[model samples]
Target: MTFLEKLKPHLISDDILIQEVVLHALHDYPNVPEEWTNELLKEAFRNKDKQSSIFIYVENQTFNEESVKILSENIPLMDPSERHLAVNLVQRIEPELALKYKNQLQAYIPKSTWALYELLLHGTEEEVYSEYGQILNDLERAGSDQHHLYITAKKLAACLVKKGWVTETEIDLILEEEIKGRWFSFNGILNIYMIGLLKLEKYIPLLVRLLERDEDSLLEELSATLISFQSDQVIKEVAPYLRKENSIIYAASIVENMKTDFAVQVLREAYTSARELDQQDILFEALCHQFSEKALPEINKHMELDYSSGLVDIEQTAYSYFSILGIKHRELALWRQVALERELDFRQKGNDLPSAPVRNEIRVGRNDPCPCGSGKKYKKCCGK
Candidate 1:
């Protein structure tokens, strides 16, 4: 078992030192199990030390009086970053409770944050829009960081557009700023997400032009935007990016989710023409994602060539990519999964190193709903 597995039982221990250590270790494990949710949240409030990762621990959880009490009582004990997160977390889950902390939290955060949260919770569209305007004035006066306003002011702006409150011209301007200001939110992914949400196909050229950008912060979002458009023009724009190290994963993902045989043909062609191992590794992975009779021979050929040449690092790279995919359980056929495992075994039996575990991590499983909000099974979309 890993250090986390060994220490996980102590996560809610009465002893603070052990719990804090375990809590810190929890950051390494992304999807904290549902059972640990309450205790971590309690510690998130109770711990005097920083627990900045409190957001991940309480991801799908909503607010309750119990959690609120714990958090409100420990607000003063939290570090600056922790306080920022606490305010955002509370505002998101239970904005009324966040408003209750406004007097206390204002000493630390961007101005008018709690007010915006309250408007979000209780105010009508008109009230929130009016408050949004007031926030712009406050931001200007303070010379506030756009990054600090994302969950508050930026969220309000997103809501305005989502509710059809913004004009198309206004949305175009917002899209430009959101995409350009990578640090303002979830990178260009969230920006492009607005476009996808609006089903704004005319802006594919805008996205295509921005491909010169290195906005790989969230491949799932970028991939979703491309999948939403699914144009030959998009596919054409993304094809060359398949060879680039930074962009290849989602470029390949875009091809995979397009779900056209032409997309498969593109991958096959990309693989055949590719020279570098890094380039081929990604192309080959996307081709394997297709999982056809054709892919099996190609997969085997790679195994035979690489393992026979004693390229264990190649296997290591593959394991790392699977981790990137965050694939809890691959949704392939029994034979297909075995084919993958057997290929790893092919490397292990010939080499001295133990086989890399085919990661059945506590991550998004292939059949799980896509986190990208695409409403398809992950395997059919981004995880494909």
Candidate 2:
């Protein structure tokens, strides 16, 4: 038995220190039996200690399947603070289980807004979405509190789009309500609007308005999303921004969205004009994604310059780019060659001598023990 198993009985009474220690130990060693974690949590709930409750909540946050079951069973009976923690834990660990207790959790929504937010954002299994729809309808009708309800609706809209239950039109209708009433931030509304446009690319005019109004960050995000639709109008809309000094980053991002040769040309020009490390890095990185046989010579030339100045770290970047493009190991032999050359040059220049050849030594003995670390002679073990 482990230390936590021995301390379980004492944790039942008032030995808070033992409980905390066992919890911390079990946290470090997650392989501990799920029953032990459940028992300690039950004891903490019986004692009504806030600190122990918090610890269990945190442990549940990091838990696997077995530990999550314990948390779900015990969460409803916990006090307000413990209940909130349990709700948050379930939302993260077992979202389906959390949805099972949605009605019971409704009372805590006002006090536990962040927990609700997490559930709406990431806890979006089918059951969780069903529960969210119920919650939204309930909040809308009852009018108990508007703050959490508005946030929940916005998140629900995003989740609906992701699930394909609601179309871009429905999302726009919701955003129209939100913007008119000043229910949420303009930026938040704009983000959801962009998501809508991403799904329904026909909304390019609206996106152009957002871009013209100086919403650069949102425009950049929208450009990336619009790439899936492969629309030239979107590229044209973002071209003027490409020339502006402040807008260069977003422009490069937009150019990456365009997969055509025209887009590659724009990226090459941007790479030439880009002076900052970050801008150059983004341009080169995007080019690597857009790489083709036709673009290889240009990439090779830029890589040579970057290597001489030590401005670009090529090996890691090349590996990442090739991995994304599904380029095989054999296809990237040129990159491996370049890396080997750089390593050799560094050794020769820095050490003032040619590197010695690496030697491999082989050993064998007929009557000796096997080199495989088995307690037997070579012939009887691996050699046999």
Candidate 3:
């Protein structure tokens, strides 16, 4: 018998497992008549076997207009768990219809879930803020589930941001409440970052405080965001991290993008003090792009090196500097010729070395030399 033919007998079997198996088997038969699938789902719902119906609807991705109609019809009959999934599915599948039954749904689903639905349905910002603002204020400190807190906070914050209603006083209140209430999480931090992006003057100090903790969790994202301000305070707060042995490469790149006098000084100092070639190259690239008078001295110093340090590759450094400095067309031709001749000389001097083999499964620090031996650090090469 065909798989569907064999599975049909179990649909009406008294055995619950048989009924579940039949519903699961239907997933592979997308070509099955819509009427047949709808009748099966309805039968499952009628028997209060909502789990089987929902599994097919949600997990198996078999939900359709027919499924929405069935769930909406059975909304009153479903228990809490069944009602939650049914309400969610209806809202997702056909939002206008979900709006028609919003009052009924409020009685079944969690308040947080219902609020998200209202937001998705485009409730006015003032209305959303009036209802959910107090809810966040009351519940945020009680250490509620990050899921509910995030869903509510993210949308509410976005509304406030869009309306230009966010203020230092308001931001302070939000931050103070969350801090006093201890509602920190990845989502919570992200919500604040979003708000901070909109209102930096009020929030950068708090961000600076978080960075000082040096937790390494979300540090890269936080630093990247803070540096975008390009303020002196932010530069001072972030510059020290570039000098850290472990954080140098990431901090270097972030500072590179800042492309300010402060950034150049930080990178130049770090490059001079750096013991490793990979770190130096990272500093080199950061400097080459800026190519200011302050940077030229460092570029000249590196270009004067006579031998390859396995990591520095002096000839490569000179080519990068000349290209970035906008050396004229004739100078470019000469540099390319000189670079090739240097490569030939290095090859003849037994100085050229083969790169290391790539490891299929090995973990190393970002600053560590890449195992593939391109003379680049792991972070810049294979580790990426």
lDDT string, candidate 3, 1-384, tens digits: 333453444455454323432343333223355566566656667665344343333322344566656765777776663354344444343334445666644454566565565674677767766755565665556442333454455556655566666665666665676555433544345546565457465566666555534333245446546655656666566567666666665566556556468778877887788776666766765565444557777766665545444433344434544543445333445445665665456445433333434332222334433444343445566657
The digit string of per-residue lDDT tens for model 2 on 1-384 reads: 323344445434342322332332233232345565556555545555433333432442244455555655666666663354454444444334444555554443444654655565566477556766676566557542333354455555555556566555666776566445524443344355446434566666555444433443244344445554556776676665565566654465556546567776777776777666555665675565454334455555555653332323355345444543345655366665665566555445535532322100111122223333332334344545
Q: Ranking by lDDT, best first?
A: 1, 3, 2
Residue 251 in model 1: lDDT: 75
Scanning candidate 2 in windows of ten residues, the lowest lDDT window is 356-365
Q: Where does model 1 exceed 4 Å of error?
A: 1-158, 174-190, 216-221, 230-233, 307-384
Tens-place lDDT digits, model 1, residues 171-247: 56766786667443332345566676677778776665555455333344556576777567777778887766666
Q: Using alpha carbons, what is the TM-score of model 3?
A: 0.43
Error of 1 at 227 (Å): 3.1
As a whole number from 0 to 100, the lDDT of residue 272 in candidate 3 is: 84
Pitting candidate 2 against candidate 3, the one with the higher lDDT is 3
Point out the higher-scoring one by TM-score: 1 or 3. 1
Candidate 2 ranges beyond 4 A from true positions: 1-154, 159-198, 205-224, 257-262, 272-278, 306-315, 319-384
In candidate 2, how many Å is residue 331 off? 15
The pairs that clash in candidate 3 are none
Q: Flag regions of model 3 displaced more than 4 Å.
A: 1-122, 126-159, 165-170, 173-184, 212-217, 276-278, 302-321, 328-384
